[model samples]
Target: MSIPPPLQLLLACLAVFSCRHFVASHQESGDWHCDPDDEARIAAEFRPGIVTLDGRADDWSNVDGFEFPLRPALDPDEDHQYKSGKMTVKALHDGKDVYFTLQVDGDYVYSKGDDHKCPSVALMFQIGDSATYHNMGGCKESSNTCNSTNCRGYEVDIMHFSIGNSIPGRLYGGNSVNSVGLVDMYSWNPHCRNIDASAPSGNDSTALNDWKGAWWHSSFSTHPGFIEDDSPYGSSAEKGIYYFEFSRPLRTTDLLQQDAQFSIGKSSKFSAAFWYPSDGNPWHGSAHYTISCDWIPMDVISGLTSQHKAASGNAASLFAFVLSTAAFCVSIFVAYMVSKNKSIPFTPIDDRL
Candidate 1:
């Protein structure tokens, strides 16, 4: 039994990526292995197969400045195209930390785009807080959307996955450059109306570009000074394992905790909600904005893609397989009963005339 060089090559490539693919040549009729006429999933458009994400923690939370009590969500999908990994979360008195245990499929393709340097994921943390902070262009106020203004809060202070920043794929400031956080407008001063109500809305006018480029213009003369600019936060950075620590001061649990949003290429459409409780030093003096993020090696597509497969594809297929198997047995039983009734034994009757 000698394996051909081509077959050997294929196996070697598989070894480079993930050995857990379970991609046996025994799919379908199983003639796809050595029949020379076999056509199967592994044989069709399969290049060691790139992996995505599956499995998530059913529930997780953190209390004020208390240690996070979380159970890592292991890669439960053993035979999945992409295997999931473990995630650990904890909250500290001043900030939070999240750690992910990832071993990429090794077959995943490096992302391509303008931000080609880093692979990133956008993020959004709940909305409708009692107040929204607008931190942009050296200012930290409260608002949802900004107008050409590069404010501090307009951009959140977070990290994510697959971003284009220079981080050698999965490291600091690498991914999590998504634009999920909200952006809003603010005036020169703290006053809500520092902006003129009669200002035009086009970038063509030199005057307009100079004065109204607060939300976006890179070099507006009147734009606030650039110091510790937070353009990464409020954007899509939710793909990483967010190590949320600290509980809110009071138990106003009725309020929405996290209205996280995610978007691709500056368009904010992908995201979900994240909720936890209030914990941390109640008398830590000031509620300083503190957050931490680590884009551990990205092993698979997480968040949305994961939710879809788990809730739709995998669950439905397994359910159907079991149902059909049961139905087939029931049909065989009925056929046997019918044949038995027609073949009942009886004594022969002899008629004499």
Candidate 2:
């Protein structure tokens, strides 16, 4: 009634394989665990009208900050830059609007084709309940075309900000024009942008007109229901650290746009990337940027959570421990079987004796 040695070894191998598969699946899935050290947290202490859209970080000093390291673009051919850095982000929300302050330490490089010096940053958030891969949706395909609007299955709301280049001649200390920045915020929903008439068609002439009546220009004139404010803090001469503040209503009335609306108490997933252009067109130029990884799990509460989410957080450690222990036990069993088999020597035939 006992199992054979070979069979025992086979069973152990299968167990080891299962343990390995479990660990690999979790690692490769790119699922976002609400780890306090790995994932960034955004405090929900914003009050309407309390935060002025100024680039100053004085108001944000008390709030918690999350750090996201910048890396080269996932697609080297489409977009590539070698430079690396980190962006520190802080968030707050009034009942009506949400404000974000991002600070980075890098040289200010203006967009391409522009005469004045400038720099820009962008934030992308996944909209909806479905989970999607974070590498800009380029998981299954061999090519990097997953970034294209047609291949993506989920929608992302983008908040793009630029410093010192929105206006042309408004010089700041004769180096760059103006310190206050501009925001070109929009939603990237392939399903909606392609079908909705109010959404901007995929054409060069109407590209900036993603939303009806919204204009991408140097001035502050914006379309109705479109609310965003931005400002940059840093001297054109020093070019040291730069601080940026962006504010917008939590929910917009523009139903045609692929924007995400938020309630008072809920949770969402967001991913972010930054581009530092080197040459060519700022929008299309070759730039160094970061790879979009797992989502940054955020809670829509009045304050930051004292600890990570109980249900989803700490999964990485717990799962890893279980898998490792299972794998180790299987390995030990296999080794014991092999040793036992070797310890018993073969006996000579009786006729020869």
Candidate 3:
């Protein structure tokens, strides 16, 4: 019961067409299937004055970190994970500002004047209620049609750091006088990204990068600071962990709503990305690894402990009780003295009249 030749050819053509359409649709919509771990949450506790923001992980010893395997941002296949190790993310807040530390194990590799050859990292945060982890905020509009007015409620705040132009342990970002590799940015989608308050047409006068960060490696020698002359600061191919420290205000003066405002005891959605030059090859813009296929939950916690609050409450109550007892005693003494000394006042008025 073999099919006829013409019918067979027709059936083959239809199968090929259906396969092509399926592939195209998958690429267009970016159909993502991810089961984010419920326990994988990053907590930014109230740890004021715990870290120095010098890109050193020693100060963050007591802070807890969540580890996630780094997978390709476009294709998250476990077999293609970063060969070195998983990345550890730690965060904390000081009531005024939020801090982050991204630690990834990798061989030291640096190339002066080329950020693509060096390790880099970026953080994307959901700034709008409709924003999503996919497609960088998941704005539907194309580049031409995407703008603040049209693509509202799809903003995601981004902070990117390329260590090639940045000195190890040196501060970058939020400096209007010069441009380091660390930059503050926002995006409606991957194709429509810009500096805060900036656009394709022109730069806004009020635009300011309100981010500060620094980078370091475990192989580097201990030093107060390193200048630009310290190129290739550490030996290449040395096994070590890279540390990227970042900080920004919990809330910014961004009337444009280009920044993510974090609140104490509240949660926010964010994702982290890492770009590494594998085998000495310069990585492209889109070739990077991410923590998860979807956004990760981050909690900004308060500083006060339950025990501390209870102690304060008990002290206040004791003070109030003592003050009330002293007042009662004084009132009773005054009444007794008045009653004993003054009884001739009421009859005098009528007698004189």
Q: Pick the candidate with the highest lDDT.
A: 3
Clashing pairs in 2: 46-93, 46-94, 47-94, 48-94, 81-288, 110-118, 112-282, 200-210
List TM-scores for all candidates, in order.
0.20, 0.50, 0.78
Pick the TM-score winner.
3
Tens digits of per-residue lDDT for model 2, 179-223:
123322333321221211122332121112121101122222222
Per-residue accuracy of model 1 over 166-271 as CA lDDT, tens digit each = 2121123211121111111123112211111111132111111000000111111222232223333222322333321112111111111111232211111111
Better of 2 and 3 by TM-score: 3
What lDDT does candidate 1 reach at residue 124?
A: 22
1-353: candidate 3 lDDT, tens digit per residue: 23344533343343233122111322433566676677889999888888998999999999999999998777777887788999999999998999999999999999997777889888999999999888888899987889888889999998878777778998887655333577677888777777665665544545567789988999998586788887889898999999999999998878887899999989999999888987888775344889998999998987775347768999999999999999999999999999989866466666878
Cα lDDT computed for each candidate against the true fold: 0.23, 0.44, 0.80
Candidate 2 stretches with Cα past 4 Å from truth are: 1-37, 47-50, 75-84, 109-117, 131-153, 167-239, 278-286, 303-353
| Better candidate by lDDT, 1 or 2 | 2
The C-alpha stretches of model 1 lying farther than 4 A from their native spots are: 1-305, 344-353
**Per-prediction tally of clashes:** 74, 8, 0
Clashes of 1: 74
